[model samples]
Target: MPTTAFSAHYSRELDVEQLGWLLSGDRPGDDQATVADLSQWAGWIRTDIRCSSCGKTGAQVVRPSKARGSQAVLRQAHFRFVDHQGGDGHHPFCEFYGNDTGEARQTDSLLNFGSEKSAETRAVRLLVCKGIETGLFNQATIRAMRQWFFDMKSESRFKVRATPEALAWARSLQRHPSYRRWTFHPAQAEMPAFDWQAAAKFQFTEENLALVELAKTVVHQDAEWKRAGLMAAKHFGQEVFNTAALQPYYEDTLTLCAFVAKNSGISFGKTSPDYYRFQGAPIPLLALCALMLFTSEWEMNTAIAKFARLLASAEPSDLSLGNMIGLNPFHDYAAWRLVILAAEVAERSLKGFDYQAQLTAIESDLRRQHAIWKSAG
Candidate 1:
């Protein structure tokens, strides 16, 4: 089952955590709620929520509440699909299919970072180069790539030595003549030693700290907005931040921002210099390489689609070059900045690689996968 559901009322997807916040009577702009308001919103969700992917109704929003037992226990809110007469199920090719089935898993030993000649590796390298050149690379894309890698690792049929092999293979890719230009350069500033395992750790501590610092500067003008900012930071700290897993917290973060805006009447339109300062922080080369090597066309396309929606919904002023370079109020500003930095590094490193052949190979593979899925369906 998916952790997120599409809300027809809002015309956007929301995770169960966000729904839980709403159930507590927290509206998009206000934290305060009355019993009547809570009941009303809960009814709204029951009517409007549906499958994010297939748009199928019969999706239910489960709120966090105490269990009816001698020792009462609290449960976390989540989304689930329910069956009833004539109700539609998920689409045949939806990613949710086979997710919880007891199907045989692929063996890790059988899953290798194939040689340079392999189509998957070439496709990944080419896509990264193209993304940087086209100015489309961002945090969501990076997250998608990482998610693909972790999905593979998690689906291994048998336990195998993965980390050591993955690290060595990634290092070899980084050292290749075509990739070396981007991974290492004499004129570039000193970088941390290449460590795939270490780089995989999502160190949001610095970003969260920077966000809190930004919030502090705004306290003089809007105390409620400041509170919302701090609350968002705290929420980030409380949630598990893993580069390798699906990012449900991103929705949670956005929901918190929406709450502050709707409840407190604070406009996040004006650009803040402090937000821009933190955007300039450096992302590691090895991490970028890891992202490129594991990313699939499907994952990249999904990420790009979501990013496109964010851009389409943003205000014209929010799309200014300076605002785009740093954080803006449109989406997850901190995450967006990270993507920008990553793209810069990627573009500089992939300056001279030939991309045409890789593109051809990728398109061919995509067509083949689509055909197979179609036949299966």
Candidate 2:
């Protein structure tokens, strides 16, 4: 499928289903998270991620982007959305200006970013910096790194965060040893900054882990995922089936992202996996379900129904964790996809990663930027 079509479908799915879920407040208490808390949580997730990519154990990534200026808010995002439109006319979902086609003037708010820190940019910047620091990463590598971090944190949506220095630091880390693990490729000559103990300090708990498991399974199932494909059969499949590979990766690195984030307690980005899934409640259960359905290769239909029943049992009379699988606006599939790729890189560089899917999502999201869209066209 073309990128536009995939995004259109994703948007349509969210507009119709996910929107109702968000508005209806139908998710399990597990997904319940306050944006107020998300900042600090995101900081922690970054800390763990920092350790993994930068090889820095003694000095955790400093969260310098916490206090932001007023002009850096989401107002400019409005213009970005406008630019995304490219005057190509709005899709069926757009209704903000009360019109679909015809050029719309940029609103004052459109010229600004929301006071909210861009979690997506800041978080991804940390990962992106890993790219820059490690050797000369190509633009595609940068894209992959950025896309991966965003997916790991947001699942698939975008997160906004931190300040200018936050972005700069993220750039710096990529240059360190961490960015080399962008996709679990062949072999990395770069040594990690932290020893094993430090790696264990930070980790992803809650929903972040839940989503990582899902994304891992996704990477496993995808034939396009070269190294992971081999590893998946050996680890995700046989290990789960016979050898028991699921928890090792999570224990050593993924969970480290969480533990590190929790201990570091920095607030530079939007929604770090640390912040959102800081605890071990709702996200874990969701992850368990995802594993059963996606990885175990068990009865998927039964798994879907099981999760559906779990969602049904939750409050609001109607909600399912599955609904947000790839559509949550707060960084859904796209972010987690990166996490999966990064995990692969942690062990070794892989010629695998589903970037095409991610690019499609980003291109579509860019359209939502409006301003970027107009400029692109």
Candidate 3:
């Protein structure tokens, strides 16, 4: 008996009969395996499939017996290679086989169980500003921060008072000794400049708890990743993304990106005036602006003013968020991290935001710009 490495690529769970048609000697017409077709098979138990890697035919889907009482065991679709007397020969060097070959097989083990690799080993190295560690800010903090900023930007009048909830959270944070040295005056006309030195010195206090702590050292090297990359894409398994893990790394930057994307009416799709005002320009550049406004360490008024300036001058490109995720600089952990943050921002913005008011403001601003241009002419 040989064991086969499970591949997530075959998303469809094939019954004995359907699988027979696929593995049949007679060529079948027009239907190739697709992720969409197999997507429904995600939680279903599959059986009687062939292993594409080992050329092992009639591999039975293995699952454990159902549990009793309130304790339910999750059953997964997998395969164990069994050779019937007349069946096709199994690959002599099946990676999934349990036998110890008595050789230095670190490479083989990693290749076989790559997806099962723990985050401790696979944790991505990030260039977080020195003071920040994991759990510095949580989702609740981000929502309040973004909402406060949004209110500051949207309200027309001077010094609109903060809600008790907003003021309370802010006051509580300031009382913490780690943040006491840093000035946080949201009412100030200018954004507080980021003090990288102060930011760099932050250490965890008993009051604040982080979800995912920063890794001690880099374990899986890029060289190891390059080697692992050579394996077929199917073995990589589904990327287990924990957005909470990114919260400590990103802080408020994530929420800000989301606010810009949602309020600016920029999303991932082909450009149009209805969805994105600039029909042919780079949408991501505006998103980049949103992230940068917060990054610039400016206060509420200055950050809002900077974004207004961007809307007036920035041009659209053929690029989108989906497009940016595939390109360099934007690609990698930052893009995924932003995806989580942006989604969270967008969701919150939809429920509580005054989109109609924002739209009216934009239209009025556009009219003002037109008048200015005409006067100049």
TM-scores of the candidates in the order shown: 0.25, 0.21, 0.19
What lDDT, from 0 to 1, does candidate 3 have?
Answer: 0.30
Q: List the candidate numbers ranked by lDDT, top first.
A: 1, 3, 2
Candidate 1 local lDDT, 1-377, one digit each (tens): 44446555644344454444444644342222111223455546656876544455656544434446642324323454554552334443233332312112211111111211122222222333345434555434443443444354345322112222222222222222331112212222224454322221112212123322322221122222232243234333232222222223322333333333243332333433233232211111122223332333434444434333333342322110110110111112233222222222233333223233333444454445546665666
Global Cα RMSD, each model? 23.8, 26.8, 25.7
| Candidate 3 residue-wise lDDT, 3-121, digit = tens | 12222233222222232333342323323211123333423322334443343454544432234563332321224455556333345323333322322222322112212211111
Better of 1 and 3 by lDDT: 1
Candidate 2 local lDDT, 1-377, one digit each (tens): 00000112112211112222343455335333222212333333223221111112111111112234533333211111122223322221121222212222221111112234233322322332232233223233322332333334323222222222222222222222221122111122124442322222112112123323433343222222332233233233121111122333233333433433344344323446543333221222232333324322334455444434433332322222112111111112222233344443333312123323333444444334544444565
For each candidate, the alpha-carbon lDDT, in order, equals 0.33, 0.27, 0.30
Model 1: lDDT equals 0.33
Top model number, TM-score: 1
